[model samples]
Target: MNDKTEELRDIFTDVTDGEETVTESQEDTRGSLERDERSTEERLESVVQQMRERYGFDDVSLSDDELITVAKSFYEGDSDAEIADALGVEPETVFEARMALHLVDEDDADEVDLAAIRNREEDDATLADEYDVDETQIRRYRRIAAAEDESRTANDRYRDEFDSVLADSELSERMTTDVREDGLEDATEGMETDVEF
Candidate 1:
């Protein structure tokens, strides 16, 4: 029994010799974890450096809660002063945060009236004035409306063509059925001369 156990051990060792050892895998896993940790630290450092440069701070620090507040303020389009007042930070700091983050663009047309621009009753300048946005944004909105209209028109044309094709197919089927019935009647009449029924 001892000799048999030794032979089995030898076979197991030979089979496993070509594979990676447990220690090597553990070391590789450790190396990967260390690399990921360093990468995360470097990214955080870069973000902090950007914030510092934008806000003109010698040493800037932000808690997670402060960051969330800043993001919310930015999304709401609050002024730098308002954001600073809300976050209890300097206006200069809010300005830097806004410049660095840029949650929304100056030319966003979310609140603009696109239909008025499409109708030509309202020009881009007029819409811009009404919406209190840049004229370029109004023009962008108009272009988007025009593209949407074009797509709708193309879709309508395709639908109409499909309906027409369906109608024509039905008409052709009816005509073929009528012709077959008339031919059958004519054939029955022609064969009546040779029948006595």
Candidate 2:
């Protein structure tokens, strides 16, 4: 050993009363390990329960399992019609359920002015006539706009939880990479050079 090595050895031995061997006791990790053993479905159910309790979604017609299905399908980028098919419900029902769960799509409230609707004193029928939209459409848009406002106040915590439950980061990254590579290949399909570098 070099001088520095020998000096370190001497210091270590002096600190250890000339002992040459050291042992360390690891912390008990069984509890933490066991906690992580829950199935994905169970974890999702737990999060759904927490959401229900936190938001008191008493008016929602969807059951716990249906709500989870909606959230999972939504995060997976399914359309309302597709989600409705999965749940054996109409698309309008799914829309209402999404509003109840604070899952408003960006375009759901885009057809009319949400600020105008919020400030107006007219009923749904009157607003629908004034906006030249269907009465149900007016109601749906108003509810979606309200949910969006509420979600903004809550920092979109519920949506984040919904995303985390089904949107695997690794899978998303891999899909993104694959899509980018495919696009690049398509863009360069006829650009190959005849001369070698």
Instruction: Estimate TM-scores for all models.
Output: 0.29, 0.63
Clashing pairs for model 1 are none
Query: Which window of ten consecutive residues has the lowest lDDT sum in model 1?
Result: 30-39
Tell me model 1's lDDT, rounded to 2 decimals. 0.54
Off by over 4 Å in 1: 18-79, 84-102, 105-110, 113-197
| Clash counts for the predictions, in order | 0, 0
Q: Write the per-residue lDDT of candidate 2 for residues 1-197, one digit (tens) a residue.
A: 99999999999999999998678988876322122356667877887787778778866778889987887787778989999999998887777678766787776777777887875778899988888988988877778777887777778886776665566644655776887788899998989578697
Top candidate by TM-score: 2
Superposed on all Cα atoms, model 2 deviates from the true structure by an RMSD in Å of 9.6
